[model samples]
Target: MTIATTGEADALPEILTERRGAVQWVIFNRPKARNAITPWMEDRLIEICREVDADPAVKALVLTGAAGDKPAFMAGADLSCLQSVKTPEDYTILEDRAETAAMALEAVRVPTIAALAGACVGEGALLAACCDVRIATPSVRFGFPIARTVGNCLSIKNLARLAAILGTARTKEMIFSARLLTADDLAGAGALRGVVPDDDLTERTQELAEELAGLAPLTLWTTREALRRWRDHGLPADGDADLLRLCYLSADYQEGIAAFLEKRRPVWVGQ
Candidate 1:
């Protein structure tokens, strides 16, 4: 995790929170890096998720990126930022922060809506999967492009969540191909609440959040728990850390990260 210096707590938060009527908006605020989050940022988001859970007045949550000229919801982790890692332990610290935030947000009693635009890749898309619903604009693109880029493995929790939403076959295809699925593709696969034009995304998201907020509270909480439990059930308990080590420790994995930063194709020896 990124540690703050003596008084870094006085600086602005990495993630931004805004309370709007009955909705709590959690925006991924790292715009220059496409909202690519650090371990510290993930911790902040997880804290926000917990705070929202404690507030009964917050009936719903809306997640989005800070809309900029390019407007990425969130993309793959900043390649340059991740290149500092030298050990499995270091990498796990970063990955686990993101995973913990996803689970925290997903477990909230109130519903979540990910209003996405632009690219949502890797851990970013994993966060969207945690939301109770997703809506996006035509400009949105979603994928895990690590196969061609980082060569890192997904955590068991992330893999299970993907499998639950897209099924095993489709998830495998997505990783193997390393292609970004467009908004339409994600909608067709049941990962989205259908596409809205870029201009209407905000309005549509608020409308959906309102609808969810007005539903029976007990039913919403119960059904969400029912869903959250199924995701963890029956997952393979063995070999997850081994898989992470085998891949992240490989020469090819280093090559992948280096080549990506250098804007060249990685030469993989597979060992």
Candidate 2:
């Protein structure tokens, strides 16, 4: 069943939900923007996560991008939205929404799978990292190119998440390089469960999701929760604000956004 959204008749919802047997699929549908997520989409995603968690019949939750000429799980946050964020407060609000959405998905009771195809960068990559398993096509390109494109920084919690999956050194390199990592790279790092051919992506993801759905739910839930707790064990409750403020409230960040919109190279002057 498709969830209806309020918008122009020809406009598609930013998020779409489909239920097939015991697997629930949540799709990012803004193909025109390379499926860049918006605030509305984040809200919808949180709602879907809650729905999936409350429904015992849903054995697996699969997240993917709607097919397009250029497939993208999610390119990142909508540039238009990011362009509007100018203050540390604005960035904080945005980060909070994103964090809530990610946490909701991570807290789901059943197994979660990310079926990735094309570009999965920035917020997209973070969401993918939240999944219990990621199955991708060879064409997938995943990373946070913020240093080169957005001049923004990831929250400490986000860094921890990536470090947990890819290790501290790899995560630092991924951000520092400002380049998208290939599916093979991620698979080698053990970040992805598997990488399949583009043609076999859907079939392989379905097979894996179904296989996971057949597992003991309690065992899966216990493992997921335990790992999450372990990851958060030593995390600090405060102290990232200065780091975020330094980036978000800088001239360089605005220049980065302007340059990106203008299709020109950003001239970063470390402020």
Candidate 3:
């Protein structure tokens, strides 16, 4: 595996960077908090998705940890953004931003891998699950604890994707109980292609990414689009439009935005 790392202080802090051959990487840099997804990172994440989609040189993209050493491949949403969310309205705006990033992950024109390690929780799990492939280490833990942590909802498209990938029973257990599954458990449940020792995770991920990158770009993109279309069939028309509306029209959305910019807890008025 050819590894190339770049540290750009001018680059967005919430997300980091690296590139290998035709494989482009977008690393979630908030390791201290287990790679928590911040609002700034949200925009950066979408931008990276667009960047890869538009760049002809990037045939396969990987979303992974910075050097694959974090305690979490991705932990989840940044809870710091939730305090001012007093009403469902305010909550939806935040959710919309997150869903946009997630949608971009799904819509990437090239093959994508969620090279997961450590804890893949909540939003992180959703992000990984959005990828075309998920590779994990033995130490990885996966779950969506939103039912317990916040009243936030997952977009129907993402919910359907999860159900398709993990199956109804397994998806139900994870969401309903907010249970965290170890790598072995997730593998048995068919959530990941394979699990390796921690040391081999990064190399194996690179191997897979490079392999995909070698394939014909148009073929890969067409395949991804076909799968996406199939998933869309399972979702209702205007589903995403409604999700966007739910967030755009919410009072909580207003508070959440203000609070995020202010770097303080949102004082929700439940407008």
Which is the leading candidate under TM-score? 2
Worst 10 residues of 1 by lDDT: 1-10
Q: Count the backbone clashes (under 3 Å) in each candidate.
A: 0, 0, 6
- Model 2 residue runs over 4 Å out of place are 1-10
lDDT by residue (1-271, candidate 3, tens digit) is 4222323322437677688888888877766667778899889989998998788888788887654234567777776676556555665677778888988988888888988788888788888888988888877888876544433456676788788788878888888887788887778878787888777877888899888888887888888788778877857755675665554455655655556557666655544
Model 3 TM-score, 2 decimals: 0.80
For lDDT, candidate 1 versus 2, the one ahead is 2
Model 1, global lDDT: 0.81
Alpha-carbon lDDT, every model: 0.81, 0.88, 0.75
**Residues 50-152 of candidate 1: C-alpha lDDT, one tens digit per residue:** 8888999999998887655576788867665578666988767766677778888888779989999998898789888888899999999888988888788
Candidate no. 1 TM-score: 0.92
lDDT pick, better of 1 and 3:
1
The TM-scores of all predictions, comma-separated, are 0.92, 0.95, 0.80
**Candidate 3 local lDDT, residue 232:** 74
